[model samples]
Target: MKKYIKIARPDHWIKNFFIMPGVAIAFLLTEHSLKDINIFKLICAFFATCMIASANYVINEWLDAPFDKFHPTKKNRPVVTENMKFSVVIAEYIALIAVGVILSLLVDKLFLITSLVLLFMGFLYNVKPFRTKDIPYFDVLSESVNNMLRLMMGWFVVTDSSLPPSSILIGYWMAGAFLMATKRFAEYRMIGNPEVAGLYRRSFKLYTEKTLLASALFYSLISTFCLGVFLIKYRIEYLLCMPLVFLLFSYYVAMSFDPDSAVQRPEKLFKEKKLMLLVFVIIIAFMILTSVDLNFLHRLTSNSLVWVRLD
Candidate 1:
């Protein structure tokens, strides 16, 4: 059981949190009553995504086992440590993919499309010919595309229409890209060998501290702008919460630059108590402020007549 859990790569499950933003943005934009929302369908979408993502991780680990054995940190993974058999991992992958596909099909056509796209992308990331991560820009592009698909999956599950060019979605995408770039930067700095970096990822050579810093700064600015726009568009009084977003981005960028502090594994930062506390505090504060003026903000902008009269 322990081996199976390790093989499942529970640490990667954190990525599933991507589902929340779409649901939150959809609710914020549409103002749909909670009772009317189909929570079950959303849950199904979340589960299906988790299964598919986990399967991808398993396959990736299996394929990279040889290289991982040389990685300073990744060498400790169950697959690398010989705690799990490749055959068992393969079986799990097949089962996960099967269940993920069936569950996704049960939802809607949009869900089916998103699931298939994710599966194909995962295969392309790991397999040859279309091994996107081995290419130059395609590496970052593939990661960003997957992130966008995950965000869209949630939006499709909730609302049948295509997601609008909302500030929240844009902000989320920028943040995701920023994180991806930082991950590559950190890996390059930690390994100190371009060949090893390239072994793990194809875009490692393209990243440098200066380039990464610039990219991070650009994304941070765009994210902040998008969040501000979201608040204004929705007439949300919690625009003040925008500072928390800035702080979070700044903290991560600061850590990413410090060789000792910058964790090679991007997911490790989330597990750190101090970092998690800071994130928790910011989220709690934002929630409180947003909830406080919720009704008033809704009333001020919800009625079409109110906007016309103001004009």
Candidate 2:
């Protein structure tokens, strides 16, 4: 059981939280109308996405076992620690993919398409021929595209209308891009050898700390600007929330520079007591303020429920 759990890398499952952005965006754009919320569909879609993402992680670990063995922290992973066998990993991967596809098909055609795209992307990330991580710009492009797809998946699940040109989507995309660049930057910094860095990620050779830092700053600024616009357009007055976002980004970047921090996985950052408390409080406050009345907080909640039916 321990081996299996380790193979699952439940710690990394936090990335599955990407589902929240989609659901949040849908709510922000529509207002929190329970009618259009389709709780059943949303729950299933979330689970399906998690399974598919888990499968990708399993496959990535299996394929990168050789390389991971040399990675300082990754060497402790189940696959490298020999806690889990390769054949077991492969079997679980197949099972996860099968479950993910079946659940997606049960939801709708759109979900099926999303699942297919995710599968293909996951394969490309590790497969020999078109290993996207081996290319320079393609690595970032692929990650960004995947994030866009995840957002679209959430958007389509709720509404049939074309996505509005809201600041929400822009903020999401920019935030995702910022994180992707930071991850690459961390990789480059941790592994001093240029060639080895390139072996792990093609983008490492193409990106310098200065370039990534500049890009991260740019994206963070864009995300903050878009978030403000989203608040204004929705008549949400909780602009104070902006500072929390800034703090989060700043802390994340600072952590990326620490060698000890590099040994920790990205998801673990969320588990920090202070950070988690701050995030939870901010989110709860936003939800309450937006959903309560016509105040800024209420307006924010109202926007999320735009597609919801009162009846």
The candidate scoring highest on lDDT is 1
Q: Specify the highest-TM-score model's number.
A: 1
Off by over 4 Å in 2: 1-5, 81-90, 161-166, 192-196, 236-240, 262-264, 288-311
Residue 299 displacement in candidate 1 (angstroms): 16
For candidate 2, the TM-score is: 0.78
lDDT of each: 0.74, 0.73
lDDT tens digits, residue span 150-261, model 1: 8778777777665645677677777777777777667667888877776656556666657766776777687688878877776567676777767877778767667656
lDDT, candidate 2, 187-264, per-residue tens: 678877777765655567677778877877887898889978887666455575778788878877877787756323
RMSD of each: 4.5, 6.7
Angstrom error at residue 303, model 1: 21
